[model samples]
Target: MPRTPRTFTVSDSIVVAASPEAVYGQVSRPALTGRWSPENLGATVHGTGGADRETYVGMVFDGHNKRGPARWSTRCTVTAADAGERFAFRVHAIGLRTPRLRGPIA
Candidate 1:
């Protein structure tokens, strides 16, 4: 007998019964994502708009992530932070211990 290769496509979704503010409160803070994510272990906000204050457009955050047994961090800058509307960031650098390199990450 011969073995057959396997291919799988996985997709998942969920419907949260919450208001926009509630959703935004959870999503805007990078430090809180670790509570729900598997690969992401959360982040540490740098200045001004730290996790304690409101999110802003120029806030910098160090994102910590892990996969299987490997761990790494990424230097990210918040590009958009519209309360209860939109939130986004850009990965500027990456490294194992610290993000020594700098630039727009692919």
Candidate 2:
């Protein structure tokens, strides 16, 4: 059987009554995401420097995530990081195993 490629996109936003610097301080730190994000369990910085290091463009790290009974890790790389402006990272699931779902069972 042939497999079809799949693409997924997720977006979220929150309004915080705080300075940009304060918000950036929390968002830029990968270790802190677990505290706020529901899906993200936690993250650890890779390749030395510091465990809770600030993310910069091109920085690589690993993220731990969980969804129901399934848990997985992802390799992430920071693509954009502008102080008090924007911080974005790309995630690639590691050792992911997709279950076969032929038709709508439900």
> What does candidate 2 score on TM?
0.75
Model 1 is weakest, by summed lDDT over 10 consecutive residues, at 5-14
User: Deviation in angstroms for 55 in model 1?
Assistant: 0.8
> Cα lDDT of model 1 overall?
0.84
> What tens-digit string does per-residue lDDT give for candidate 1 at 1-106?
8998565444565688998789889889899879988988999999865678788888888999999989999999888988887788888899997977887663
How would you encode candidate 2's per-residue C-alpha lDDT over 2-106 as one tens digit per residue?
999666666888899998988988888887789888998777777777556667888876677789998766777788899999888876446333223233211
Query: Candidate 2, overall lDDT?
Result: 0.73
Q: Which pairs in model 1 have colliding backbones?
A: none
Which stretches of candidate 1 lie above 4 Å from their native place? 1-14
Clashing residue pairs in candidate 2 are none
TM-score of each: 0.79, 0.75
CA-lDDT, candidates in order: 0.84, 0.73
